[model samples]
Target: MTCDEAQILLHALLDNELDAGHAREVEAHIASCPACAAELAAQREMKRVLADTKLSYSAPAGLRARIEASMPQARPQPSRRSVLRGFAMGSAVSALAASGVVAVVLRQDDQQRILSEVVSAHLRSLQAGHLIDVVSTDQHTVKPWFNGKLDVAPPVIDLTAQGFTLVGGRLDYVDARAIGAVVYKRRQHIINLFVSQTASTEHRPPKTQTMQGFNCRRWGERGLNFWAVSDIGGDELTEFVDKFEAAMKVNVEG
Candidate 1:
């Protein structure tokens, strides 16, 4: 499913209006596209915001009783003016709720899709026996390799002092955009730190997620998005994120 097609039917997918097979394919495409995932999140947030908004209008005491008493079962119901006013109010509320549902359904993919891509990339690299392009332990050597390949060179760090050794690096893709993946090792486990240049300038701490038994943590800063994926423990993976972010700061200053 292309991005445009998936986007067009996002509302249907969100509302369970699509068949299972088609929904799966659309979800698969979204899983590999970061832009779609973020868009999906925004749509969900809009739905939640609408849901949280409370609209209350209280009628005077005995209002219901008065209406019931004034009604004539055999004759015509309440005055046309009153009936029309009630119908109008009911239709307005229904319309607002329906619009909220539509807004929330727009672009219905979420962050889980991005996490799936991260895990898939890591597993594909290991299973296909094609991992790194530049095999080197020196940060200086590995960092320079991306100079001509990408618009910005990802800062490579030698975290040997922290027990994560720099192994190599490679070019990868996410959401149709080329990105850099720096390889690392902790004991026998391999860590693939995926970095992509984005318009996002979020400096918030990373969030950890387990995708297919692998623990991954991702965060963003100064238009750069990073994702570290491996089978390593969540605690250890978090430490890795902290060290990497600190190294990023040092590299920026230097």
Candidate 2:
């Protein structure tokens, strides 16, 4: 992870809000980075000091009695039927709102979990001997490498004419399941395009996300989910995906 990305997540790590996967990723980065490690220590010290400091102020013992005494003597009460109707309406509204909130939270948690896994897999692939199980530039040669290796092999597109060269392919684990990673190279930057089969055949437009200084463009099409991750610029990454998708369409039609 980059220092900048680690900085943004340090507080979340300290607050214990990050999920186990992300927490471990951030902690691993900090272990190797002295600057981030020092910053985390400082954050821990500050939190400890704040916990020890007492900032609450108590009101006078009779403050509640005085406030009650100053209230109007007479007040009107709603009818029992009206009160019951209002309570029922409020209960329904609260239930709807709570359900909506829970749905949103669950979606966010799932997204974060997947993203953390993708980033970790990408990092692991960078290590020597972990990159490609099959190394070849020809799409024909690379595409057949995954025969029987996975339920569905990812499309290996030869984008060398478009500036992104086909490096090879690899098998990686994401979200606890094996997936195909079609590796590509943009100049010196490596892009790992992770593909996994999805139940949905619906199409999802590419959405860009950044994690630990790497740009990831993810989308779904033709019952497969794609995550293209690299250190390249966002625009370039988008262009890569666009060209890739276009090429895939051409191959499918031709």
Winning candidate number (lDDT): 2
lDDT of 2 by residue, 68-108 (tens): 33655221221335334535666643333233332333545
Q: CA lDDT of 127 in candidate 2? A: 47
Candidate that scores best on TM-score: 2
TM-score of 1: 0.56
Poorest stretch of ten by lDDT in candidate 2: 73-82
For model 1, the stretches where C-alpha displacement exceeds 4 angstroms are 1-110
| lDDT of residue 67 for candidate 2 | 48
Predicted candidate 1 versus true structure: per-residue lDDT over 175-194, tens digit per residue: 44456899999999999999
Q: lDDT scores for all predictions?
A: 0.73, 0.80
- How displaced is residue 254 in candidate 2, in Å? 0.9
Poorly placed runs, candidate 2 (over 4 Å): 1-108
Model 1 residue pairs with clashes: none
